[model samples]
Target: MDDLQFLDIFRGKLIKLTLKTSSYVGVVQRINSNKTVLLADVVYVEKGIKVPGLKLFFGHEIVNVEFPGKTNSGDRETLGYKLEDHLLVEEFQPYRKSIRLDDDEDDEVVINFEVIDEFHGKFGSAVMHIKKQRLIGVGADAVEAFQQGRLCWLQIATKNKVYLFDILVLGAQAFKNGLSMILENKHILKVIHDCRVISACLLAQFGVRLTNVFDTQVADVMCFYSETGGFLPDRVSTLQEVVSLHLNVPSSQLSSLKMKSQLTKEERELWYKRPCPLPLLKVMALSVIHLLPLRLVLLDTLMTDYMDLVDSYLSSSYNEPGEVEHINMELASSQAVPFFAAGTMQWRHTPRLDLG
Candidate 1:
């Protein structure tokens, strides 16, 4: 069989590529029309370390292709290499567990919860404590409710504690107390995942703008770009997916939490209900619990591998001047220009000059 044909068979599957100088292992992303193979999540076979970005390999440069499982007579005759003999057994283990932050047995995550529903003396202290912190993980619940013109809860996680603020109960008064300042402060770093929706909700509903944001989702994309020198725009990851990838949260634990937290359309109506259940609140707490640690891990990778992009990551803010302002300014400038007579050369020349 043709080499290109063989490669096409394994597109989207994990395989090892034997080159003249070195070998690499990765999942087949695409095979270009020119016979260049693109691989994602590539790993150096000998070193057992992941190579950051997508890797492209020319068809002629490949000496042999090795995939898992038994080798048949036809494969041995056509390839002249025993697939079973050169299988990447020991070399592939590290790649499988490279992104795991912890061991399988050490899957416990502890969160210190502080529920602030009432406007009391403790509420003032909680606000003060949060304001004093330099870094906090911000997460919001009932976002679906907020989108549908209902209220939501905001959770803030520091190194020692997680504050569950009842936006439904305190309403705008919560922001007046201290939450607004904490979000708008430029000095304090807010670690949030995919801040677009939450930021919009905060701005539209409460008039609070998010500043000095270290968006974990954006950071993850940047890290991928730094490692592989490319971007996959369609591959925007969710918070749960990001946590499982970077933090190595066990699959069993994630599955259990997911099972417990799965809600139907009818169940989603509970977001507007008063006095939310303990189990549901715990589900809300999970949103921000791993954000701080996740940010730290991603930042360390960015600082070490791509120091230049670190500033870009830290400076991500939803409060920046929007595109609408720029568009309006352009419209105003265009409208200010005087129109010339249609018969004159100046009329044609003006449009050409503007184009130039």
Candidate 2:
């Protein structure tokens, strides 16, 4: 079925959707295809952040949608919870300092271009010259290359179309198994591991010690489960359900984004005898492409709904008389549970046991 057709079925149902600028969790109160209009009962921000007033949610503004539970299967009705957005923080102003890039004030150059990684080797010398000149590029892996003391791919997860200037540094202080702290419980880990590549990446990239680990699933569960009688053994929420409940997205679209390889054993065997399908490669790429926007939506929800909760975890001490220590020692120490160890020689081939 064309995915757009699901919108007709979604009418009167609850959804979490990501608008161009913000996120919302609401019910599809009205959908007039003739008028090209959509109206939703906005109950949640990030599907967890509660705010006042009903708002207009345009179909074009919707970047993604999720449907929670099994409404199609007649299993449940309604989206489940009410919620909140971020609390405000105090403002401060400081005199900024300037530093010269190089000794020669007359030597200045600026370049703007986008390069796909497929052509990375072709532009190797040009990129090296730019790095030597300390020139910055805006697309994707450029800034990451500048970091880690090398202008090349590292053991880090691939970041797509990221602007280095737009990056937000959460903090400097490190935490052990910090991913687990935001993950909350074991069931959440299993759910993400089952469908999403996030858990595996976290373990592979950071191992136990990590900085600024925030899992959106944790925020969603806290918001939804708290209002709907908390977590029960049989009622664990999936990523789709959480996104649907919090982001105002629909499940049908989420399923499409997942793009589960439906190839059977016979089909797989047949495909192995020939060149892989181009559509299959595109489908795989789409899976990763869809995840980036979803991550942003989840991050927006987490930061908005739990700013205070996050602040409470930070340290109250000062690094110096004027500089405050923002590291959260208590929070960091709390996450000292076993986390996956990816590079250990003994466990390299072991699929099940990597926790250390």
Candidate 3:
């Protein structure tokens, strides 16, 4: 509802962003103990772009969700995945140099007496300036004009007050620089501690929890969210493991591994012929891929199981009328199939076609 209320969700938890450029979005809600609902609002895509719509269906209601846009992939970028791959080997990461984590530093620059008195009552004033506090007048509105992420948001006595501040950088990297400043500061640990408290409070406020990627079982941890209980512990895997791990069983072994059926042949034939699945199915597929570990099963076994899981998840949705069906079905479609090129287009259509 209110942005301040959202702060409650982040009060005491740690925000694990894949990149410094990213800002956290999404409000946590609950329909089942198994998972928390996250609503994404105020997406930060680009000046003229908009994110696609997302929706969830309850008994007779459909809930629309908006996710905030990210400045970067955060941790994923740090890991050198995709476009960030080239950056991993570089010598100058944002963390390589000085950092500043002081609340004093984070504190508003004391407005100069002259400017403070001039703006007092008339406009309400707060300066987010990196300028000398002795200045006659300065305020958060000034800092915001430059879009300083480090400043969060500058508040004056009045919300309508306008102050002037200049941005140190032009775009996403500016946010990174701001966060890096926080990371490198000598007081970083303290700020981080504060961030944790803030995160935890936020989660509790939003009725959600912030999960540590490492604590959750996963090989290559990309992203995660915690509602009351939105997950299953991943297989104990580390970043080192994700980077180096591969299917250990020899290709010869795969011949012996029978792929399990996911959808029944009827369903499979129907899905295979489609251009793309319904969004609900896609989300379900993502849940399956993220939560299920059968990706290592022999291709044959994988195929069979995927068919079974999908069919069950789909058929069961309407089975119990008005039951408020809420399920977290998982699919291991990606790891179960080999990659191939289809004409001019290249796609990783795991047996079930891994779109994400």
Candidate 4:
């Protein structure tokens, strides 16, 4: 298989590509967009086409973009003429999983969970073959993603070659790490950092970082080294530190004894600035209640005030359609299960069961 052509996933959503071969700069409107073909706006010397500055004097000509890394000197100079600068962009979305298509003989077939689990045994495995199929299916997706060289470029040079423990995975692990630092029942600044990191990492692929009040490496994760007292400390241990050490993680994990503070009771007033329960969880639960076709307002969110809020603001509004699905997905993830007794019930109905 042509690994190079398979680089479509690397084809960014809305990349700002500059034409290397031409006299004028042309902006790449979209590549790997959901549309069948890409649309680009050229600004240089082209005619006939109407752009603010560029005209398609000649018919459309396909200009190539050089991926940021690993370019040879000559090619770099040619593509370099366009210059490298950050551009606003959107992430590419995969086609819906429910869709089906004609198969190519050489195409590697992947099995999704729903298909395998459809038949418990006769078609599935003897000792839970359906589950085994699902594991294989998901692994295949990861592998196929790798086979196409689409693994996160950030982690490529790292030892494990896996994306950093993302917030979800990190949060799952956090419970094991202990609640002294983070809490499952609440939204910690660290958790917000995780969300930002995941989103930033995705955006960073196109060379972007959404700078906010949170420091680099996140507030909770940063360590500090004080010069005056010859000591090291946690950046988020106080609000004062939050103001000063806001530039990414403090120098390093270790602090020198030369800058030690003589104070005994380490006070941290502003560390946990917002003591908020996961209200977003409530939003999430209500969404699942709305989206899941189950005919039950019997769920907790179905009965709660959150339902009213979602009805007016989000759950009711029709989106133009795209990555906005992530918001819905985040909402569904908020509360894994809802309500009590019948309200919390989640299982296949007994009507389908054969008593015999």
Candidate 5:
């Protein structure tokens, strides 16, 4: 594969790209057959800046493209240009898995879990493969478990340097946090940061239209409202509350489970700084582990109250009739089966499945 292709490596990253005639900076929207497209949010010029809706640069016209990390010049001239109206984006609908009968594939499948925590400014995402009560993590401590073949079945993203998993952008809300954080209290920033990363992980991609993937908070809300059958008093619940209610694990026990770390207040300033202490890793690791038990109880709850949850989801009236129809289509095609790569998984008798 052409790993160096600017379109492939930095497909979704915000970039400062220099063309032969002018320099433009924006999010790399997509890489089509012939052109590299950008949502040209900002245009830099000698006198001032401009906000052009969308700009496309031919593959050959692009002279050079630089990512933020590589550009250390610290030029103030290049950055986000303030726009009058920001885009209002809708929440990403959760992916649904579909089942198909294929002799090559087995109906029995392994359960995969991932948890992401934000420390300092960086994201720490942990992955685990579970089957028949066995859990194998991808980390230094989990190596022995892997050697024992506990994780043998997992179709790991890595193979011949190309990762099968691709990063999928769930919503623009994830990118809009900075403005909201300034209005909110700094004390809560850490909590907000943690929650955002977790939300991102829920929407993270291993394969296209990932199935059996969930956010603990979303699952909890569905289960809670399904049981109560009313509008949620609190749209979002704290992680501690979900743990207490669903897993029957209290916050105090979770606190005790975290390993002790030597990180001082000064060092704690940069939580992602390595080597990440054992205590911090333990806490991060525990968050992933907690999801395991939570999934068990919540999954059962969801199945029992599936219709109630559907009613709750559909109850929200959309402004446009087409919008409602679109949601119905998305919900109808969603599957709950184990998801692998896009081509490997196929929906059998999709028309019958959707109608049902």
Candidate 6:
């Protein structure tokens, strides 16, 4: 039987769903007309840990389904633990809190956006805020803006505040003030998704070299290889895909954001407009807001699940022998390495050892 037929049979029963990225076990609560399955009381199967909240899975995401056997109604036990255990419920509450890009909806994050233009005061304070933060999320709009001989908006996000720098209005003054110093600083950790375009633009136009970068794209590729022991050099995941996989952001929300952020020929011209549209500015801000939190989640998984690969990749980035041991200690203790240290490292092929 196909996925829909299989789900129909297993309604209200405990089953394990094998998805492309991860596995989950839960009761089939409801099946929508669109072939989407609502799973209640979900437990992340790989870690054998229960996660609070109901999870919705699309038909395309279900790779395979296995009946895990009848659920014990007396004590509500499955996999040797009570599904309603109070202690376990409290422990998994934090996992449900995810970074949201929605405007004015997320109370957990204090997202403040400022338009830095000619009238905006000196950029020194913004640089000071960045230097004070342990981690920074950097994003740019219209990656080809520099190559096309135009200006792009640059977004820098800390834990609470997001600064949207109007490069067009500020011109070279923005970089001269302090942008170049931070971008080239090797000590401050900046989480950027796919730095190739940004790196090229900065180097060519501003005469600044981006250093100490944590490329989320490369990190995702590493995580994929670790899980499957398979490497596809040609496969590069989009930002939307990565966010969905790691953060569990709903497909509908991502689809809406994607539609809003699309830069057609006409939309591309908006970047050069004197007063950039609010909708477009919001999109740019939203892009980088979740990056820092996403990095934490990815790093936690990498350090726990694939330490060897982490060691190899991180050690390759730094030259000092002592630095590697220090980083390894941090990983072992589940501490986030504040900086990438030396140079950015790409994921390289490593031979898989056969345990059997």
RMSD of 3: 28.7
lDDT of each: 0.63, 0.33, 0.25, 0.24, 0.36, 0.65
lDDT of 3 by residue, 24-122 (tens): 322223233323333322122222111223222232232333322233334222222111011110121121123222122432222211112112232
Predicted structure 1: lDDT: 0.63
Tens-digit lDDT string for candidate 4 (1-356) = 46445545443222223344553333332333332224333323332111332233222443554343332232222323211111111110011122222231332232111111112222223223212211110011111112232221111001001111112212222223332122122222211222333333333332322222222222222122112111223122321222123312232211211112122222211111111012211211111111111111112322344555565456434553343343342243323321124213332222211111
User: How much is the lDDT of residue 85 in candidate 1?
Assistant: 18
Total clashing pairs for each candidate: 1, 21, 62, 19, 3, 0
Judged by lDDT, which candidate is best?
Answer: 6
Query: Can you write out model 6's per-residue Cα lDDT over 170-273, one digit (the tens) per residue?
Result: 66777888899888888888899878768877777778788899888778776766565444233456666677777766555555346644657666665664
Pairs in steric clash, model 6: none
- Model 5's C-alpha root-mean-square deviation from the true structure amounts to 23.1
Alpha-carbon RMSD, each predicted model: 26.7, 23.9, 28.7, 26.5, 23.1, 22.8
Tens digit of lDDT per residue, candidate 5, span 65-180?
77653332322223421111111111110110221211315332322222222222212121211111121111111112222311101111110010011011112232233212
TM-score of each: 0.53, 0.28, 0.15, 0.14, 0.30, 0.56
Better of 1 and 2 by TM-score: 1
Lowest lDDT block of 10, candidate 1: 347-356
State the local distance difference test value for candidate 2: 0.33
Best candidate (score: TM-score) = 6
- Candidate 2 regions off by >4 Å? 1-219, 232-245, 258-275, 303-356
How many times do residue backbones clash in model 5?
3
lDDT of 2 by residue, 203-318 (tens): 44444222233344454443443333323122334444554454445455556333333434344332221111334323233233223333445455545535765554443332
